[model samples]
Target chain A: MLLASLQDVTFGYGDVPCLEKANIEVHSGELIAVTGPNGASKSTLLKLAMQLLHPWEGKVTLSPTNTAGNKLVVAYVPQQIAAFNSGFPSQVTEFVRSGLHTQSSNWLRRLTPQAKQAADEAMQSMGVWELRNRRIGELSGGQKQRICIARALAMSPDLFILDEPTTGMDKESRKSFYTLMREQIDRHGKTVLIVTHNLSEMNDMLDRMITLERREEGGWKCCTTTLCSGHFAPAESLH
Target chain B: MLHYDFMQRAFCAGGIIALIASALGVYLLLRRQALMADMLSHVSLAGVAAGAYLRINPSITGFIVAIIGAIAVEYVRKAYKTYSELSVAIIMVGGLSVSIILMTMNKTINKSFSSYLFGSVVAVNQLELTMMLAAALIGALFFFLLRKPLYIISFDEESARTSGIPVQWISVGFSIITGMIVAAAMPIVGVLLVSSLIILPAALSVRIAPSFTSAILVSMGIGLTGTFTGLTASYELSTPPGGTIAFILLLFLVSGLCVRKIILLASKSTSKKMRPEIAVKESRISKNGLSSNLQKIRQR
Candidate 1:
């Protein structure tokens, strides 16, 4: 089943268009990697899919079952880890537990043994279990990224959207992250849509690649390539 | 001493302000916008000065004008998201400028500026206490009802929006609550130090607590303790109560830092001792495994 669909979407800030006429479809249990240059609106596409930004032109729809009839159950890991001030002094466990913000009226009252177990499972999956008691400010870049991913996973979301997940990681850490993602997708069948500018690093792990190109005619063209083809041709070229 | 009505009123007013400030402080610290509270406090000074000039009730006028200033800050922030610090700087300057203008106007009108600047705890009547209590309760209710969305948005706005949390409303609601708390705290802590009552305790708590709930609890304890100490010290020393409270809060913050450092040092030494033991155990396990393998080979 199609988990998310963006039909002829146009998005921008004020008058300047960041993305135009872009369309994409995501299926369950699929791993789609969105890659483009820095200003190519790859992140914008993920934001649109996550419903963080409204499409200026077309409709972006999610399957009702996943959204629980309200919106998609999306778990997003943002690109800029620095967006959070490190000096804020939140514990890793507390930060990860914020994933359950929607599960109860008061977050303090709803932290039962079951919820803790789920958080522990998420931390264990991300290899950050030992760091749960540590402050978030004390963590290294790779560790912080993993903790964020664990936080997103603790939501038990139907779709995980990550923007530049491997931006600041070392080679080994990036490989380990891809291994973890593979385990999540293959064993647990969680759908994922990741936006990254580093195409070469994620080439092997991606099930499909989607590219957003700014056209001379004042819009964006989205082209998708299956893993078997090993190349992303232009949508117009394919037509 | 127990028969003194003013003392009872002072305690009541101080308690209410402490509650509101500490609760609001939690969100301010979490959102990393603690400085905004300070700016709001300064802005409320102008409100108090305006009230004095007009011979009106300073608390009511302070509350109204502070809310308007807070909303203005939010609008400016929204308009300049790319340069958020610029928005804050503008608000700070605007608030300071208005305060100076109002204070000058009050001087021309022969109104005393010291009462608004330093506050008069002896002047906190029954009506003012009632107002403070009402504001505190309302602020508490607003926080409790919107805690979930507030938490999500505080941690990560993009993630919160994607998860279907109303990021915009949460941000606006938090700003409004901050304004209300600033207004409520002004009469007790005064415009100069009111924001400290709404920021320092929470910051100190965040440094040590494991969770947001614990942080808030710790903040409330610190706030109440500081408020009582500050009031008593001010009464004894014949100084401004707000300055005393700010000083006490600063001392608590310093102690928190020292305690945190000591804990870090202790944990580092303990980990150092355990590291060699872990390495030795791993080597011994490897040696035993090799010997057992050799014995099995001989038996085969």
Candidate 2:
């Protein structure tokens, strides 16, 4: 099923168009990479897909049937991992447990056993379980990013969207992250969409690539691998 | 200590303020809008001054006017969404200007207004205590009911919207809660010191707790501790409780930082011992000529 679709979408910030005439479709268990230069509306497109921004033209729809009435379960990892001032006291486990916000109803009480187990599993999957009790401010950038991903995973969303998930990481860390993402896509059958500037670096892991570019005649052009390169291949054409 | 009726009222007021401030503080710290609380508190001062000029109960007038100010701030923020900070600055200036104008217009200066500006523990009466408890209970209930949506909004707004959480309403709800705390805290800590009662404990709490629950608990502990210590110290030294509470809160912030530093140092020392294993692994790879072999394969 087409999990999400953006047809002839145009988005703007108060009459200043950031994206124009863009179209895309994302299906289940696919790793789609959105790549473009700065100000090509990469982030804006992701926001539109996530329903954060309403498009000025065209329709962006999430199939409710695919979501199965679990609208609150869509996980997201933002580009910048938020920084708290020194002496921020939140533990890694606590941070991860926040992902379960959609699963339970009580706000004032503690997490349930199932919620606790999910949080633990998420931390373990992200390889940050050992640091669960440690303070978030004490973590390195890569470690913090992993914890953020773990937080998203704890939601157990069928669809996951990440904005620059591997930014500011070493090459080894990036490789490990892609491996984890691949495992989630393959093993868990989770649909993934990521917005990244470093397309050349991520080419090997992407199942398909979509580029948003400005046309000479006014308006934006969205070119996908199948339509632009005339290559209707799947993961094989990624490299 | 509890024999005096006034003291009992003061303690009750302080307890209510502690819980409300702690609850609001968690989000304020999370959103990094601690300064907004300060701005709102200062703005509410003008309302108190106006109440004093009219010879009306300042707490009631102050709360009504403060909610209006909070709504004004929200409207300004919505109007100039991109330049939200400018709205906060404008409100700060407008609030200060109003206070000065009201004070200058009234020839007979009210001592109560001055005491409120600096804060006075002796001013908390049973009526004020009852109001504080009611406000605290309502605030607690609202947060408890909307905790999930609030968490999502606090962490990331865009995702929360897509997840079906009403982002706009949540923002409004948060502002209302802020207004309530500002209102309830005024009678206990006074206008100028109210923001401190909300922010300091929450900031310190976030440093030690890993989860939101733990963070809230830590904030409550800090709030209660600060209030009790400040009250006792003020009574013993014949000093103002507001200043004492601020001083104690600052001390806790510094101590929390020191503890974090020590932990970091200890971790660094432990990681140093693990470095040799990494070095040994590298040496083994080099000895096996696997690195060069990979390089040769890549070159082809």
Candidate 3:
């Protein structure tokens, strides 16, 4: 299923159009990576696809339902989100549990037994269970990153939109994270659209890759993108 | 103090505003709009000045104007998303300037302006008390019913949107609630010290509380304590109630910070002494490659 798409899109922060005439599509159950040089508006492209940003021209579509005819659940982890509110007064357990809030049908905002189970499972999976009682502000950078992903994991959404989710993680943690993401796709069939810089590390795991590049056009910097079949192509070949 | 009917009204008004304002402060502080209370109070002052000039009740006009100011700020905040505080500053200047001009137009208005500026215990009339009670009741219901979505949106509006939340509407509703509480609180704390009632307790609680819910509770506790004690002190020493309340809250904030710092330092030292090996291992983990190595081992 087509989860989300941006076609013939033109967007920019100011008067000059930086990302112009860009096209990208996200399919259900596929892990897609969006890579680009700095200032290429890669994050903008993701935002456009997610309908978080309206395009100056053309169309953006996000399917309202999943394959099973249920309301689509989406979890987004924006770039530098851990650093965004580092001083947010919350414990690790409490923060992770919040991801389940949308899933609750009642208006009471009470924690159900199922939500508790899901939260604990997500924390344990992300290795943040040991630090569940610790305040979120007190955690290390990588630890903070893990808990954030864990929070998203607890949501168990149909679509995951992540931007630089591994910024503070080490190589081993990154590797484990990839393995975990693979399990999420292969076992549970969740669609993920991620913006990443580590093309070499993520190349093998991606089903498709979208690359954004900028070229000078008529005295203005304009962006274009290339979509490639990921599993068969090497990361170096794209460059 | 309770012997007087006015004193009873004053305590009731103070307690109600303290709870709602402090609660609203947590959301405002987290959203990086702490100066909003100060800005709205100033804007409400302009409304008061206009009310007196027009031969209307200043409190009613002030309440309407504060809500309008809040909506205006919300729109302006969107225009300057990267520098949201600029909106507050811009609105504050407009509010203060208008109020000053209006106050100058009516020379006799200065007699009542001091009470609005500095606050008086007797300012909490039956009408003001009723307004405060209504605001508090509405504020409490709003907070309770929308707590979950508010938490998510407070963390990150963009992400909250993707999670299927109506971020825009909730944000506007939150602003309206803030305006109502700020306007209601003006009678008790006045324009100058109103924000102290909102910001100080939340400022301290956000630092010291272990979790978000606790932060709200702790702030309310601090606000109630400060309000009651300040009122008592004002009656005893013949001090202005608003200044006395603000001063007490300020003192609480200062002492809270000091106590928190000392406790953190003490805990660190004692932990190091109690578990030397664990401390050494932690340092080594920092020096070496990944803390995930320890995490990995712990996972096993």
Candidate 4:
């Protein structure tokens, strides 16, 4: 059930390394959180996992589930950046519907019955089903954020990744979001890795916590803290 | 004759360009690169001027230069990621300035330039029509085939790539495709007004349509409707086809905006009137223990 791993991963921007010598393994059906301080390359690490960025000095490999023909499916919902291009003209349902576009081959097909059911259930779970007909641009910050979560849910991927999706959400909303994530992990057996700064709120829900911090010697190093204790061991030592 | 050969040819070329431009416009508008069509058109204009100066086929030169300019826009956007609109500005200015230089150097280029600027549908030669058809073919191929990738990319590029989409290649391919369309559309709407075809219809469609697909389809409808109407008006009035088409599109855009505003205003007034009553009703329902928090006002 080892889904993916980044071996000796080192990545940087313009020659200056931010994440270095990082090795991480993702097992199936685990809820994990990647926690770090500012400038700790947390987002960069997510990029590597999602294959958006390549390791300058290492390898990233995904283990093919025997049933999946060497393909490891992943769905990522990025951090809620305020500067996102809001010019997109999709209703909430339509936005979620687009998430399935990546998984299927047939382009521009009408929302199949399955896609529609998935979208409905996802929106219902995310508590945005009522907003299905509303334009995405007309929604508030938190409402739009929920729509992002709904999009990823609609994908129903084997490995789900989220980057600080609750940045602007209120306390009640954040709690519900985490509960929903927990349900996805426990009931549905979906593997999830989230990059978040809200460790105080997330520690209880996470099965494994990966800590990335600037090393004393040079580039950043990562450690894994298992269970709800919020402890850390260097990745090398853990292995 | 109700249908002259020239009229038939012009409409044939114009209709295809209209559909392509409208579809491409939705993607650009969604990406907030609404001015991309305009920038590429200007770039094509410079190429046309250069070709006319050299006494070569301007359509060929326009396509090549526009593609190059489109690629340059991608690079410039990456370089200035925080200010992506800067690329459009750079291309627009650079293209116009280059055209000015080309015009000054070859005085006879003025006549050719006017034809490009105003667009004489009657003068769309067999060769030009053939070129437009080729561009349309390429445009349609990319537009339909890449629709899914383009949708996900425009929705959230980072997320799209995270989901294993080939974002860079598709984006570059899209740029080239739009460039081809702009080059093809230049002779129909004129280089200066070509972006209007890409932008106005999309802007209008998004306002009225409920989904991205419908928005695109609506945009194409607007493009076709506007093109045929403008073509007829131009033929009757003996006006420039490019100007007539652009003017018609502007009317559509203005009307769409007005409709959206009126709808917004009307909804606001109605909601304002209903708010207090709804709150009272909600409180009464809540006391009976069957109601959700209608006490909390939803933020739009």
Candidate 5:
């Protein structure tokens, strides 16, 4: 089923057009990688899919099959965790536990038992349960990334979007990240859209790869490895 | 210090302002908008002057003006989007300009400010005390209800919005309440020193606190303690209460930084001590195993 779709989408900041007439589709339980050169609007497309931005001229739809009543739960991690730095002053557990506020209806927010359990379980899954009380600023790059991923897992999201999550991680950390990605897909059945420059290292956990190309005049062109075999010989070489 | 009713009222007013400033200050400091209090307080100065000129209660006028300034800040911030501090700077400049004009128009406004200007704890009358009490109670309620949202926003705005938290409304609400609290605190800490009350305690808290909740609690304690200590010290030394409070708060911040540095150094020393001990223990164990292997070879 279609998890999200964007049709004839064109968007820009004032006069500089970034995306034009872009059509994209995401299916349930699929891990899709979005790759592009700088200014190719890969992040822009994900934002539009997440409804963080509206296309200047087209329609964006999410959870088209499952929108009977409840809004789909989405967990979106931006490229940079700007507030996170050494001496930022917060514990890993508190930061992870904040994800449970999404399920809260009360103005006075507290984590319910189930939400707490979910957060703990997520932390355990990410192998950061032992570091729960540690300050976020003291964590390593890989550990911090897991903490953020654990935060998303605690949300029990139907759709997950991450932008350049592997930018600072090493080879071992990237491998562990892929393992976590497989778990998210095979176990939890989430539809994921990842913006990455590490596509060459993204060995086979992906369901699809979408490439965005910046055009000569303005806007961008969207292409998939499968549909345009000529552009990428053997399709796998696109990675 | 406790011999007079005015001293008692000063303590009470000081305690309230300390608590309110501690709570609001932590969030502002975390957001890197500590200047919000400073800017709003400056804007409130014009109101204070206008009130004296017109023979109205200055704190009341201050409250109204600061609230308006906060709203203006929110609007200007939204319009600028990229440079939010620019909005605050503009408002601050405009406020000081208004203050200069008001002061020039009515020289008696300086006398009006004397009661709260240098924080004349001796001058806190029944009306000002009641006003401070009411503002403290209301600010407490607002903080309690908005605590989670505020935490979420401060931690990360993008994640907060994605989580369906009303970041915009919570931010605006928080800013307004902060302005109100600064105005209410004027009589205790004075207009010039209000930002110190808001930022100093929180700075001290974050330096040593292990967690977010503890940071807030520690800040409140530091604030109240610093304020009361300064009040008592002022009475004893015949000094200006506001300047004394500010100096005490500075002392607290300095001590906090020193403590954190000492702890860090101490931990590093202990870990250095443990590393060589671990290495020796491992070497001894390996030597024992080697001797056992040699004994086995001899038996063979």
Candidate 6:
């Protein structure tokens, strides 16, 4: 259901454009992984897709409505979010429950029973329920990452954009995390565009992979591939 | 103190600013904009100087200029995303420089400006009290209605934006609110010491509170206590309200931090005596700022 697409996008931090003429598309119910080497601007692609970053010269479009014809709900987990703001004074439950703030109909009203259940189920699935009462600052890196993912999970968004969501998790935890994402896509019909370096771990779960490669002329471009057979195509050609 | 009309106004003004500004401090501190209140106050001073020179109402001009400064800072902060503090410094320099030049040109206000500089809380008139009340009401409503989104943005703005919160509008609104509070608070603590009311309470509260909501409550509690105590001490000692209030808040911060350290140390020693292995692991987690492994060990 063409959830989001960035076509011929050009963006950069400084004078020189780092990502030029990059393109990618996300459809509803598809689990996609965006992978590239260090400095390949993988996160930039996701940011562009989410409208967090404006493209210097290209069209970046997100569906205003989901397949259900309601406002499209998106949840993004930026890289190293927990580590960057480690000293933030919030209980794990409080932090996770805040994800449902956007879903609540009234700003001042209490969380509905369903919303509260979603928050609890998210924490339980992520294995952070026991640490619900603990301060977020007190958690380890892996624990922090899990709770952050749990926060996004609680949102029950139509689209999930995650950047390196499994940075510090153990092998078993990472596998379970992938399984949960797969369930979100298959059972709930959610769309996911994840930025990851652990391509091998998520390869099986992902329907497609987008790799950012540096051009000889000095900017980056997106190369899309179907995960199972590795059938490659230029990002612009895919759509 | 309560018998005198001016004293009554001063206490009322001080109490209101303490509550609103302290809650604001929690958000500002969490957003890493601790210096924003200080910068806005300095910028508002430039407006005061200009108003005196032009024979306009200084408080009105100062309030307008503070709001302008906040909006300017928000725009500049966006440009210097990686160096957000640099935007604060740039605006501060511009503000202070203008103020000094304006003050030099307006000698008639030199003697009278001490009230605005060092803060003559006892001199708070009806107009200033009304302005403080208005700002406090607006601030209280802003914090209460937007508490949920504000929490998410404070933790991670990018994520909050993707989650459908209007991050830019909220960010600018937050700045405007900050400016209004800073300007309104000027009469009580003056420009120089206004930030102490906004930053000090939250600084201590963030350290000790268990959750985000508790942190705000704790900050307000400290601010109210500090302001009341400072006002009493200043009245009794015949000292400057601005300096006295700032000093009291600083004392609260230092004492709060000291008590927290003492408790942590006591816990460490007791844990070491009872479970040496767990104590060592706890220290390791504290040292490195990671605790998942410890949680795993506890679960096992």
Q: Indicate which candidate wins on TM-score.
A: 3
Prediction RMSDs, each to the true structure: 6.0, 5.3, 5.6, 6.1, 4.8, 6.5
**Cα lDDT tens digits for candidate 5, A116-185:** 9999998998788999999887888777877888888888887889988766677877777777877788
By lDDT, the better pick of 2 and 3 is 3
The regions of model 5 sitting more than 4 angstroms off are A1-3, A54-56, A61-68, A82-85, A104-110, A217-239, B114-116, B274-300
How would you encode candidate 1's per-residue C-alpha lDDT over B1-300 as one tens digit per residue?
325787677777887788778878988877767778878877777777788778887778778777777878888987897777677788878877987887776676435556556666656877677778887888888888777677677777778877767677667777777777887777676777777898989879888877666778889999999888888887789778778888998899999889899999999999999999999999899989998999999999
Assess the local accuracy of residue A73 in candidate 5 as a C-alpha lDDT between 0 and 100: 77
Model 3 residue runs over 4 Å out of place are A103-109, A216-232, B271-300
| Tens digits of per-residue lDDT for model 4, A30-85 | 88888877778888888887677778999997765522554666888887742374
Give the Å error, residue A239, model 5.
Answer: 8.8
Q: Which candidate do you rate higher for TM-score, 4 or 5?
A: 5
**Candidate 2: C-alpha lDDT:** 0.76
Docking class of 3: medium
What TM-scores do the predictions have? 0.82, 0.83, 0.93, 0.85, 0.88, 0.92
After superposition on all CA atoms, how large is the RMSD of candidate 2?
5.3
Show pairs that collide, candidate 2: A88-B206, A88-B207, A89-B206, A89-B207, A89-B208, A90-B209, A90-B210, A91-B209, A91-B210, A94-B211
Interface RMSD of 3: 1.4
In model 1, the clashing pairs are none
Deviation of model 3 at A119, angstroms: 1.4
The DockQ for candidate 1, computed on C-alphas, is 0.40
Q: Clashing residue pairs in candidate 5, if any?
A: none
B256, model 1: CA deviation in Å?
A: 3.0
Cα error, residue B277 of model 6, in Å, equals: 6.8
Better of 3 and 6 by DockQ: 6
Best candidate according to DockQ: 6
Tell the DockQ for candidate 4.
0.55
- Candidate 2 ranges beyond 4 A from true positions: A67-72, A82-88, A103-115, A169-189, A197-207, A218-239, B52-56, B78-83, B255-300
Q: Can you rank all candidates by DockQ, best first?
A: 6, 3, 4, 5, 1, 2
